[model samples]
Target: MLTERFRFLLNRFRDRLWVKPLAVCLLSIAVAFVAKFADGTGMAKFTPQISLDSIEALLSIMASSMLVIATFSVSSMVSAYASAANTATPRSFILVVSDDASQNALSTFVGAFIFSIVAITAVKNEYFEKAGLFILFVLTVFIFGLVVVTFVRWVDRIARLGRMGTTIEKVEHATAAALRRRLNAPNLCGVPVRSNLEGLAVYAANVGYVQYIDMAALQIWAEQSKVRVVVAALPGSFAAPNNILAYVIADSAERTDIDSTAVALAFQIGGARLFDDDPRFGLVVLSEIAGRALSPAVNDPGTAICVVGTLVRLFTLWSEPEPVGGKQAPKYDRVEVPELSARDMFDDAFTAIARDGAGVVEVAVRLQKALGALAASGNADLREAAEYHSRLAFKRSQNALSISEDLEAVAKAGNFKTKHAESVSSSDGKQQ
Candidate 1:
């Protein structure tokens, strides 16, 4: 559990600009010390024959040029992020900003630059003896090699980083991973969370999204107080003053205020919802992107179609059976939380696309086919949701299209169970 906590903290820190560069600089300095001690310790004999002055010149050039390059890289990334926000959905900007590859590449470049500056300063100070000099020279060459590799990789990644298709793929991957995590530990591996509770309702003190719920702490308090706790709001849910954040259920004889504050502290309320615990947010973002693409100014029906395919992939994944057998018992069995609804996810994924792209015959046809395919996924809830959206999209297409042929095409593709009866009624009205 401590390991998991440490892992969570490390992951949270890893995406930041300072963490990796600081780590790389410290490690480089540690190597410099190793080189200092190993200078005349038969290590220099095995080291390369590069001269100190040559190494210092290279380091100086790298230090100056790399600072410029790093600044330019940051600027380019900022431009790309702005473009992505404008072209794609702004909700996905966080993922682009926190890109692991981009962060790593930038860190490597900046870290190498810092190492160069420090090495150059040390060399000018005559801190390194000839043997130590040879070691630093070798490390400098290694750093150069690292810089070249990182630059090549960064170039490739930056070219595609903020493109609409690439961003969609990135969001989809993040969403799928989040969904898998939820699939494994729905309700945070606790009993099913319920909305109803007879216990004392604990309201939030702030207005924000419930970013994370620390079930471990809740279970601890529940265990200590000899009561069952029911979470009223899960992660991604908005919380407000006097809103029930959770319900504290205690025995009739027990006092209520014992650990209520501590329990409240466990919920990590934040300004925005996180993508990790909120699959619905991901779906909404994808739908928003599709809606943007379908706008008259954009008119990119292909993107909407791609998003439809992605949604189908997501729902198919959702339909898979969750893996069985955890190594330990459920961590917070006494805490009850609600399961995510397939219906909500579907609406988030499709409703906007259907409404916005309704006029485009190609988009409408693809939407029908995509929904029909999802309806065949063998999950009853998914089928029902898909059919419902299909009918709504069909009706929207009917209203948006002025041409009779386009309307008929979308109606034909609807594939609703009542299609025959509707067609018959329409024929009767036309004949009258």
Candidate 2:
């Protein structure tokens, strides 16, 4: 439970551009003094003596060059982030910013710069003996090589970082991971709540979206209070001071013993939704990107079509018989979590695209085909939702498309999805 909370915090902080760089800079400063400490080992007598001037000159060059590179790295990343937010969706900004290669590149440059400055200053003050200077020189050379390699690798990535296709790919991967995690913990490893919980309500303290649910904490509280903890708002659900996050169903008529404050803390609230645990958020963001592309200003039907294909792939993941690695058995026995609704997911993924791209024949046709694939999925819930969306998209297109041929085209695709769904259901029935 603590690990999950810590992981959410870690991921949240890691996305910030400065965290890694700041950490690396501090480590570099510490490393700068490593040689001085080693000089006390009496091993200096066996080391080769090197001139301090060469080391100082090398350090000076690195110190100057690294600062420039670090600044440039930040500038480029900022531009890429802005581009991703504008071209794709603001929600995708974090994924682009959290690119491992980009962060590593920025951290390496800043770390090298800090190391050089500390080393050069110490050398000028005669802080290191001859052996220490030689050791620092070796370290400097290693750091320099690292900088060069990182720069080379980062150059390739920065070029493609914020492009529409790149951002879409990043969002798709995030969505898929979230979907997989959902598969593994459909009920947050808690018992499934089948009916309305009759209990004392624990209201959220904040006005924001539900981010993380500490199920373990809820279970602990439930055990202590001799009550059942029924989660009312899952991750991605909106939270308000007046909204109940969870209901504590206790046998006792007086529920004064239950710590309502502690129960409320289990539901982590944030200013906006996150993709880490909220698969629906990811789907919504993907739809937003497609919706933006379909806007009159962008008028990019191809991008919308691309998004349709991506959505199809993402939705199919939910139909997998088992999670990729295997699912962990439910652990929070006393805590009950509602099932993630398949209908909600379909709504998040397709509603915006169908609404915004209704007039674009190409986009509407692509959407229909994508829904068709889902309509035939083995998962009955997915098939049902897909068929629903297919009909919805077709109806919307029929209203928006003025041309007879365009309307007929979308209708044909929707008909195909319905027929295919029936055939699949019949086949399954025959096999049974």
Candidate 3:
């Protein structure tokens, strides 16, 4: 099985771009060998009395040049392939199979070996009179090749680092914006209008009051009144304006109360409640409602002002306060949570399975911890909001555990079943 696996891997590798460099190296060797044989056998040797020693020396030089080129090509190809593969696939597999430093060193050694052979052959052929000159030439080639390789690798590293920094900045900005929106409860005035009912739902959820508004009541109201009471917004959501998010029965007697209540409910839940009837009053009412809810916690107009001030500060800084509230009043600090790419997450699960064996308690525990942290810090409310998200996380973890066990079972079964069948077939054939 191992031999077959190795053969499969070798075939796959031979199809990669680096294989071209390997082919070139082999071709160079073959050409040099054929030329030497042709000259020896008097097969159209159109040379001006080329000596055997001189011919050998030229072959050595060509071989050295080919080796250097091959080494550089292999190093570049391996680095590019590994980086690209890591981006697309799992880092765990890449870590298991290859590393940048080792690949680089191997390439350099191969090139150095070829250079050494050339140096020895050149010295033997008396290409230079002084031994020092030969030594200098060898040293020069080695140093030059090493420097060039190192520089390329360094540039590649820097470029990757730059990309990582930019990604981190973007994540920080998004997190900060989200935190600010949550904290400040900014009045959505002159904002591009989107769906109002959806906006109301989100606002309700964010302010920990969405459950108060009966969904059934709203639905009943919509049907009885012959008005489309569309939810322009949901709880924990954002919107922009002239966007008719919700439409209600504008002609009904209860229309005034329904729209008023809807806007009032939306304002109560950290949303800007603006209407054609009274836009500024809507803003004042929303502010008063949010302030009254938060006032219990901070208990002062100054503190309320501070909370609003914090939102602006967070927005400008593009950051949030750390979980561990520090002294000197919690200041916003940029946070960069490493985004677990699909490959990274898969690799984490793979590594856990491979090292700890299947059905391990640790895997479940780790996953639980991860989910818990996400719940605690990820703008999620366990009591009145985010029940759906919590349930989804639980289901996902359960599924992952099940999948891990299945994979383990399959791996344990292996190709032994195939071998056993083959053995039975042979035994029957012999009996016949």
Candidate 4:
């Protein structure tokens, strides 16, 4: 219900590189002291007497080694982040920054370093008896093993982390998740408002992107106020004071009961767009990567073509059948929510690539065929959008490429015909 705001905050928190490591640091400190309680477990008798010097020596090695390793991990990850932004898109930096492997590796390094420091200090100050020292030693060995395993695995992953392919993969995964969430709950679990609201329009308190909307909260408010709320501004939408976020459909007598502050609070407006609930933002960001690849400075048509295929894979998700019970009745029927536009998604994913790679015949051909694939989807909306974009890409290629043979290949790949395919000549010179 109030998950939208929480989800937004959680996503932002994850984007910050320090959050996970700091949490691990605190946990490490806690575990260092908590291990003292194990002194009374009578477990120390089961093992040979371990000297404090041995533990201190091991901790000293870990403390010094871990500090250096943590510094190295940070440098390597920051380089990867910079590379991803430069090679892909600046918008993709968030994805690279929040990579679980990278973050976990960093956390393990820093957490181990802090734990070593605390354990060394404990041993030096005689903070632990023999039992506690044994427990700390066992935990230290466990952490050491963890560090080795994490470092090895992370090294492999970091090798390709910032590469174009990996970045593209990350973007595709994010887009797919968002697409699935939206397709499953197209109305944001609310009934559709097909007509104009005859009630008061709710203006946003600030001007920014509507990053999230707590529809359940709004539904509760509407129920209390006895109104049918129409959500006008959805996640990924830019909201200004002049823009209407929702329409509170109520009689004049019910209007006085509405709390303006509560309504505005329901919509989480932020300076940037989020991918959690906003599938379109993902599309736009993916397109930005493709656009950057298509740019003359990069001249990486292969990446752009790869991106087109990735985009096709994403759109294909839309045609897949819903899971069991996915069609359940709207939970927030008191509130109205709008669905995403297939056409707009098409524009988001393809328009920039089409325009940017117009002159590149290979990119053009691949894009045309990509659109053709989408056009073949079972969904009529997708088919229509694909058909329109196919013709558009074909037109751009025709204008950009001077060679007749290149234009012919592009057109043939597109398999495009006139608007009235029934009456107009087809690409094969036959009317359908």
Q: Encode model 4's per-residue lDDT on 135-154: one tens digit a residue.
A: 88889999999999999999
Model 2, 1-432: lDDT tens digits are 677779889999978888999999999999999988777888688889889889988999999999999999999999999999999999999899899999999999999999999899999999999778878988999999999999999999999999999999999999898888889988988988964677888898999999999888888887887888889999999999898898888857676677678888888898988989999998999999999999999999999999989998898888998886788798998888998899999999999999999999999988988898898989999999998998888778867887666766777777754644454466568779
Each prediction's TM-score versus the true structure: 0.92, 0.93, 0.25, 0.93
Q: For every model in order, what is the number of clashing pairs?
A: 3, 0, 30, 0
Candidate number with greatest lDDT = 2
- In candidate 1, stretches whose alpha carbon ends up further than 4 angstroms from where it belongs are 2-8, 44-49, 194-196, 253-259, 324-329, 417-432
lDDT of each: 0.81, 0.89, 0.35, 0.85
lDDT of 3 by residue, 1-432 (tens): 143235435534633444433454454334222323332343343334434454345445645665665566456545554543332222112221233443444444454445445544554655533333333343544545664675567446534421322222322333353333323322111112232332222122243221112233444454554444444433322343323323443444443444434433322232432111121222222233224323334333332232223322332331233322322221111100111122222232223222222233333233233333333443323211222322432333434444443323332232223543554466568779
Two-way lDDT contest, 1 vs 4, winner: 4
> Candidate 2 vs. truth: CA RMSD?
6.0
Clashing pairs in 2: none
Model 3: residues with Cα > 4 Å off, grouped in runs: 1-98, 131-134, 137-361, 378-389, 393-432
lDDT of 2 at 322: 89
Q: What's model 1's lDDT at 326?
A: 34
TM-score of 2: 0.93
